[model samples]
Target: MRTRPSPRSRRHRRTRPRSAIRLTAGFLAAAALLVSACSSGNSTTSAGGRVEAALAELPRSTPSGLAPYYTQRLRWRDCGVPGFQCATMRAPLDYDRPDAGDVRLAVARKKATGKGKPLGSLLVNPGGPGGSAIGYLQQYAGVAYPAQVRARYDMVAVDPRGVARSEPVECLDGRQMDAYTQTDTTPDDAKERNALVAADRKFAESCGARSARLLRHVSTVEAARDMDILRAVLGDRRLNYVGASYGTFLGATYAGLFPARVGRMVLDGAMDPSLDARRLNLDQAAGFETAFRAFVKDCVRHSDCPLGGRGTTPAQAGDRLHAFFRKLDAHPIPADGRRLGEALATTGVIASMYDEGSWEQLREALTSAMKKKDGAGLLSLSDSYYERDADGGYSNLMMANAAVNCLDLPPAFSGPEDVQKALPAFEKASPVFGPGLAWATLNCTYWPVRATGEPHRIEAKGAAPIVVVGTVRDPATPYRWARSLAAQLSSARLLTYDGDGHTAYGRGSTCIDTAIDTYLLRGTPPPAGKRCS
Candidate 1:
């Protein structure tokens, strides 16, 4: 379970280097001479053949209205990585025109350790759609993955275009983001409801005005194409990948397009690519409800539980949180010179809802907020989700999150009116979160670009065996997504962890870890729907 701090502010930072492909005006002249020299001997196939073939099949057609690519040098510099240097790659701002404007993509890698032989580069994406893969790799994956998995492959990470290290999409600055985090999402009246709608609209507008050029291009389809380019430059015949959370959607996209070139893939916390936005949000709402019930069950046994009383029941936990949300809306608390309202409190607590590790912190934060009228702890947790820094600058998480989400599928609701219409179904799915999250569904209603795509099933027929891991009580990527993805893929093996969290592999399920490790190291898939306690 990933535990983040409250919403504050932070700025984006470029973290990695692209492969050694230089896109310059001197390309055609130098390419002819180099090709002649390289092909002089056998004149047929070599490692370079893999590179040529990979690039030949890429989509040359970019979207019609996309901005032209603007060429950039990407100042290459050292990033304190040992035996690994950092640089950047520039690709077309739009894939249609290779000679147009370009955008910088940040890439990173720790070279394969074994010198005897190297299989190839293995790319890893920790699924946020907005989550910084480089940061996730540096912080955990690079060091923690099994040695057998690490020894034969070079571990690589790329912040997808419009994401963290890649020319990130910008929205509100830290202070403005602070206001967004505090905006009331759940309303008790028409006035409060209108306010919520306004806040969401403002957020959409901010992203549009600031990241207009990149917003439409941040779709999962485009990101998968970018990965293909990276694969070409890395000199790999096939793509080896491990994706979690939203990354599952990305990996699946790659498989959908290039199943023939697929290698070992592990999708943890998989998203159901077939679900429409409304269904996705509603399912996630229910997932959170499931996780909260688990927490409430645990809280009932704790002596310090503030919400449970002699008359309280496990079922009442949802109502108790709902009541507290109402109270905070009526009167917000002050925390560290910031106002903590129901929206922030709810977002904060929900942010912690992803992983069981943070449940204790959530309990403490909720107790303080409910009993002492202090909202600082909850605020901190929400800030972490938003990737806000202490000084009040904002990272590009929220910006990229909305950008990718908006492009991947049509908005869940057309407007507040549509959201209201869907409320009944959402509430039926999740009494605790349905109403507010249904409204949250309206966040992308005012997206700058019309959605170019819609949710559809991905049947990656020719792809190699892929492992799909799911947690029964995952809040963000529900367990059903894992089931759905496995069903979609021809060779998918489902590994179910009867646990709580956003993802299952590394969050302390022996059964989950052992199964995944065996798959990655030995190329053996766990049985379909294999359940772990």
Candidate 2:
């Protein structure tokens, strides 16, 4: 959620309308287990044309200022998993000149504890670009994976640079963040809008001030290279990975840079590297609109829903919610000694937008806000997105999110004028989402970094079998990204999860799980373009 300058956000409606905004929302592990599974390890291919060619295409490493850094030998702590021990990996602050400063990536592993054979290490990244790989390790990967897969491989994860533990991207402090989060996103006039613009400028300034050195180096390409170094250090002949969401981008980039080194890989919730800035943002806005429609249809069925009632169509329900947002914009409700305004309310709604399991929670939050005028529950959800602490301190998620996003591509818009020009197209794609998202997409226009990456297809020609997963109704990474990515990668397979939610790996689809488990454990790729309900 990077902030952008808005001169129009300050416009107080001469007469306020009702509407609402919604909120929106990584990791691998390792352990040593030796097991004889149904599948056996494939012989590593010699570095030759395919893999070596890909590596040859990579840009020379830039100076990352990561010298003078030392890997901290973490006392392996058992995180309740029998074979898994967590440690931290340290690399030079700048990989180009390893003699410079260093950064620490929080790493964890479950040792292979099986008989007959071993498949080396399998690294997992739960997408966030900022998501805690270590957290994902302890909570899910350590236990839930199929025993066959678990037994044969050491599960490993390292939080990427500028992510959870690897020298996080620092930005605004708590109070400033609160103000930035609450800044009006919807504007009716020039004055209110300028305030929004100011907020974005301040956020960028804070990031530049606090994390200038690291900000320039947090691109997905760089992160992928880091994984290579980690792979080398781990002594794996080839890298095996399971990446979700942004992790998919990282994994794909890794394959593009070091194709010959790729072993078996799974990229869930794949992002289309082929889509340009405006298209990506517009498509995501439409994706949220799709998810919102699904939520509305579900909400109407529940008797307790606040926005759905007599004659309330899903479209109307959406309208009412939007109306609520407008009302909140002018007169925010008080909650927890803070103002619970449209920005926070929208964030809360968007947070629940990721998973249908949270629909009931969203309903309750909306009801409380509508009926009692209390917005604490909703505010808390938004806070979770911002990774804000109770004391108002903020994590570096927003900062890193902005840095990576800005560097990945050019700004979607130059300013409000640019957005206004694109508004009709966006609104047509998603009447419920167009305006705000169009404006939101403009944040990169104010970014300090000149975008370096573009939306180009990453073929990673001749890479080993890679599986690309898509959740049909995912708000952040739409299903089409999977299709596009699969088409882009020469050896990619598209595994479709025709369901709701952000990513589809362990979200209870037998089809998704079985196919992926088989690939991870048995090296049998899911048939290309396979559909799962």
Candidate 3:
């Protein structure tokens, strides 16, 4: 699960509310798998008009100090899954002082398979701020993208600095992370709150101790700059890309910094760059509420509904789920030596919200925990979100997620006192998940490095046309974010999917697939206000 920033101007640092992690995990997973399943591998016409125009508009000379970094060559070799080649590219650890040191980035690509002349390379990021783009490409995108697009454009991905296989930022060991995930996010007393604070401080201190030099330089701004260098290294005149969830933020930052080089870009499950940490958390809490209501409506229609019956209202269903959580908080269900408490149960529920297909699994998990006292189901879901392997090891997803997020915006709260003051508003947004999420915002307050980026708009004024896709009931990156982002970008086209789940494209929506495919293949975005259900 990735952390999300909040809104309201203040001196506090950004943290990932519990809700934010739930939402981001769902979308990040969906974005990686949904499109892969729907891609039709068949030849199609190429979109040739925009590339030339975009390339012609690029600046004649690279920035003087950055030329060497951008011009460096990559030595590709066969690695990971078959039909894929991997390479390592060197980027300055600090852009301001290129001679100081360097960070090695992991890059991978699958050559175009089309019969005609290739358009160029198309880069993809599956969000997380921590999610592995190389893993996503090798596992999904390279083989799943529409055969037409895959045939013409080489699909590429680079693990951002401080992310997976890119000098990753380390935090707690597996056992420690397991404990962290089980920590009580909603404190009932000062003691519990202090414990939470101590845990966060420990997490920050660990990262600082082990990754001191890289901590301050892992900001999203730095990652965006890295993308520019990757663009030049790949010999692409302009960037052609697909970014989802937090990846949308990275892609937008790139466009803002290099507007003239923007080519065909698609941002799904978009994040609004204009809001601060507090507002982002509150809005995301509300978004989860909207998705939960939708889930209840669907759940109660079936006879096996865990929360309520067919006659129960969504509000009543939410109350029942809340009651179940309270029960678990007091007496956690046993599962594989670990107990399923409110934290893990709530996470398990939130995990299912990202994709509708997970609803059945959630239902079974809830039933087992509520009726049979078996918590393995929900615990399994929580483990999946945390990327916990069967052998008990963890990926760097959570660490890099926190590293990038904490550096991108101010913390949502200064301390537990601030969280106490904000509880009512958060509860008002989501009675089921609000209080825990509000308290979860304290994670970044104790960070070792101060934030380097601030909340701002990204207009990308001179960029070519960009497509912004939003799901009406998206649990993580809300639909409103897509609307706001489209409004903020000078040349953005909004494509709405009046549906459930996080992102829209290739998630069983033929209408959405056609519109996005048209944009990618023909360089003609769907008309503004286009709606797909």
Candidate 4:
């Protein structure tokens, strides 16, 4: 099993909190799969209206330096996925210096399938800062987004620079990554702490060695700028968008930077921009604990519950689970063709926390590991979180997760001592998974590149109305974050989903989906403070 950044993150606190601050835990494959299963894929209508919002920015009269990027026509060719086409976009490696070479970002789209006047391009991002928008487009959004929206608008996604096919960041080989993920994060002594620190250092050094030239340029600001270039290229005076999880942050950044160019936009599973690295990371730990309790409450309902029976309290359940982790810390169990240790086991557990639907699978996995000595179930869950294939190779998801996370903000802790000092508060915040997540926040501290951003509010003063969706019991991005983000964006309307999981839209809520679909097609956001259970 391996770890990640979420509130962006893994199944364990040791893996860093999944995706919010690290924001890796965002818009995960699970959510994509859910869309495939839960969505009707049929919004057949003769609706012709696409966003015609008044956007001030235009390509004409463009500055000579940036004109070439803005005016170039796309040469779309068939992507491997049928009905979808792919192309590459050229963005300056550094916006400050147009002459400083270029970065090629991968773009994919599925043209409007309906026979009405097309609405123009609707871009989608599944977060990660590191997550592949292109992949999400090809796999989920291009096909599974509301059919009416798909019918009128060209579904498009651009892999942010240093993510997926867009010159992805490379740091460690699968074997090296395996070791790094296995490193004991909740160090009991100085020696273990030193080992953890060394691993973080080595991981940072490897990234710098292999990807230094592109590292500093992959910040969210740059990616938002890239979206503007894409907006011009797509012939859209205003950009229409669907951004989930960390993607919410990206979309918000674009809105803040180019409020005039922003159009009908939806930010689901929103991340708050006003919090510092430590606060975000710590908030994520509490989020995981929140998800964990949700899982426990669900588990106790069934007879096969491993942690406890129907009347067992969540705290009692947490203690039992933590004890099991401690036992594995001493002697690992065997499963999944490998030994299941504390780190991997914890990661496996945390992976399911992203979605409550997986609580059943998690219960069975916990039972096999706790009672039967068969660890295959938990190991499978962890491997999926790491995106490990049967061949043992890994996708660049975790690597890019770290590269963007480390560069976006300073490390949550300057050193292990700071982590030590913060432990009590973290534990109080999240008794089940606090300590390791606090340690996981240390990864950015050793990054080779200094941070280019800090905690700040995003107030897109004159942008068109943008819809923000938040799930109250969401694990990765807490519900409050959505509230916070909506408050920050001057023209944003908040849509609350009193539910579970990482994101809200198209995850089996007609009220939630209808509000967003109307906004996307009709450019009418729901009333602010709208709540849907």
Candidate 5:
């Protein structure tokens, strides 16, 4: 499975890009980090909160003069990884006015090998307004998905505009990104807070300088429009999709925009479009806490847990981890050439929360950092989360993540003062992650482009049955979000995975995999409100 770090802005939005896509074996060895990192955290609100208000106010209609763009054909050719065919599709940069400009999107597909009759095309997006859908398909989904599902449907992916392989949005160089990632997210005082603000401003300014034109056009709404064009070009009457994390939001947006054209959709690790950035962040903070408690419960049951031993309370375990963070804040440990400071160490911990499979690695890393003063393991985990290759080259994941998130919603906080006022609430929500995540939300405050989208409900009233899956303790996209999104979509069937992890399908649950597989193969969704363990 591909693990993607939480999208840059939301911190833990999607799984890290799978290791199979990386050029180096060094990163591939750290593949667990990718899966763990993707489970970070996402800030979003409950879909039922403000969506009704927003939906009632907006008009529902397709924009004029878009028929030609949507109906255009694609000339596919072999490219990138073997067995994958690539194509580029044209979309209006400004959907409001078709002649303004064009945004080129990259698409890739792996044709089915199964003998069964084709079930049509299955578009898979491994979330990230910034994550590379093409990369995800080539590295993980094309081969890693159950052979049964891969056999009947052509697996396809389209990198959203401003994401990888498309017309990507550039912000900072490798060195610059290293500095940005290392920048202290938890401020100590006025000087530290000012430094945090300056870092955010400089990052925003750099994006503006390098991608002035594209920045304004990469909102979720526009990306959804692009999907429609891809669907028409692929000759599919309706969309067949499996969208994870933020991809859930994208899928929902498409359903809302074209309810009649909706097809079978499986939104795993769903996001609620109705929540504003602040509420999203706060809820995400709480989510991390929930996942952490789950981790603590498991950790304390083991003899090797660095945080606690058997009989230790979850709260006490949290305090122990917090103390370690404070120690790192005061004096970072050396890790290869870099240092394992509080920021990096926190990121490493957050990375492991995505999937329980990484908990042992996290425990080992913690032991080394606390006892041996060796920070290499944790640093490696942090590096994977940031998508830093062995040579120090960085992907556009973080830049695109920030770009898309900032454009999709208003800033979570207006200024440092506002964050200061909100800190107590954040801390109350998640004593361990609250302060740092709250500061991370400030990233969009100095964004160069104004947000074009707002919090709203996606009620795809006339759509086909869409399956929404939620992990009860998913760290990034909380389980409540699945409940909320399922409620918002008019034709949604809620599948509850009473388990720990970021998403459900293909993660080892026979119940989840079977239910989804049955739905895709037979066009019969599992009974609504179905529960699985």
Candidate 6:
């Protein structure tokens, strides 16, 4: 499945449906010139009570047979991205077999700029299961983050294994990816269905052919282990982190694996790890339906809405959009060398859903495509979603996304029959998005590596209270996930942003921002049931 937004802010925008998360900003890197912008645990505890839940003490000793990794020193050099320093750290390729081989991870940081000495490193991850932490660091977090927080904590990011700059997983070349993106997910005939099946198999086989070993090692658990080693190398007593979307899952995994090592942490756009692959896919499908409903509700108020007028119901608007997708299924819209088929156009629409900042652009793009018979605008958005450069190159975003997702959990569907069985539920969840997303789930059915993880709770017992932020209308990581995660974490405090878009923290809610700022700065999480709009 096409993972979130290719826009950089959300991770799992996919041509194929898969539950993946990544940083928000990566998607916009290639298409920004076109499509523009895009809490806590503990209920009932008073602010005083929360502060009393201080950062927990961590064990000083390293685990057995891994002293070399734990004690490995780093040599920082200029990252060539002014003001950021880069270094490489080594982690065991297989934690289960530390001596078999090792993988080198790229790390980058922006030192604290404030006057006195800094508190410690605050690690940041923009959760692409495939998103590049170092990329997010250099591009957004390291530079544009809050000044007050930056002054006290040295900002750090590490490219998880098999992501960008960290031996990224590569499958198809640019041309092949273009074809893959154009494949129809809502097939109308046996021929089209078989074609999608072939595409899915080819993609998995290509990834296996090119990145077999990396694929086997790129699970989130391995990445979490790498983070622990990074924390130790950074000389931090505990991990202070801000992980978004899938990053929340990563942070939660860290907390669960090493509870005593937990520190001040924020998981924005939290994903519930307790659900299996099928449930996550199903829930995400429903989440997109929710976002689309919100979009249609607002879209109808605008005069330029392509779907409907002021009095049109959201259901009616969805019906129109669904019909339009059906038309594209029969007759694709030409956009430069490539065409905007049902798949790409749908992806373009979903990309705009990540952040409402692009809603205006989506409106214009839709107006042109539906009214003027042009597809360039939507094509640009799709390209951005895939991180496809103008030069016809692709980032390993999709490849890494699939690699991690397939290994993180077993396939959501074992074959086309399974997809067919899930169709009704998927369609009911998101009439405009469900079928394609369900079919998208089929991409992993042909994966090479077996799953290394499974659905389970991450209690992080005795860990410091974590701030879990959720956007009620978040399309990718549904808000309910945040609630579930918060309830599961032993010391979690849930923070709600009753607004649109993906992650909540830096998206401009004063209530949300101030609450997180105070927590990251003073280690006092938001009080239970704190909701921001």
Residue lDDT tens for model 6, 425-494? 9888888788878787777678777766545566778889899999999988889999988988889999
State model 2's lDDT.
Answer: 0.69
Query: Which runs in model 3 stand beyond 4 Å of their true positions?
Result: 1-60
Quote the positional error of residue 433 for candidate 2 in Å. 2.7
User: Over 4 Å off in model 1, which ranges?
Assistant: 1-77, 82-84, 114-117, 309-312
lDDT of 5 by residue, 297-338 (tens): 998888888888988988899899889988998999999888
TM-score of 4: 0.90
TM-scores for every candidate against the unseen true structure = 0.85, 0.85, 0.90, 0.90, 0.90, 0.90
Model 5 misplacement above 4 A: 1-64
Which of candidates 3 and 6 is the stronger one according to lDDT? 6
lDDT of 2 by residue, 37-124 (tens): 1011222222232111112235334334431232223467775666668766766665555665666677789887877489999998
RMSD for all candidates, in order, please.
10.7, 9.7, 9.4, 9.1, 7.0, 7.8
lDDT of 1 by residue, 1-533 (tens): 01111111111112111011000000000011111111111111323232111111223343443322222233446668654445576666655555556777888876778644676878988765567777766655676666666787888888888978899989788777777667666666799778777877787788889888887677777787678767766778788898877777788778866777788888887877666666677777687788888778777777778769545665687888889988887888987688788777877777666666677888899899899988899888766666677899877766776777777666767777787788898788778767767776666677777765554556666679988888788776778888977887777888888877667766667788889877766678898668998
Each candidate's lDDT (Cα)?
A: 0.67, 0.69, 0.76, 0.77, 0.77, 0.77
Error of 2 at 385 (Å): 1.7
Worst 10 residues of 5 by lDDT: 23-32
Candidate 1 residue-wise lDDT at 184? 65
What overall lDDT, based on C-alpha atoms, would model 5 receive against the true structure? 0.77
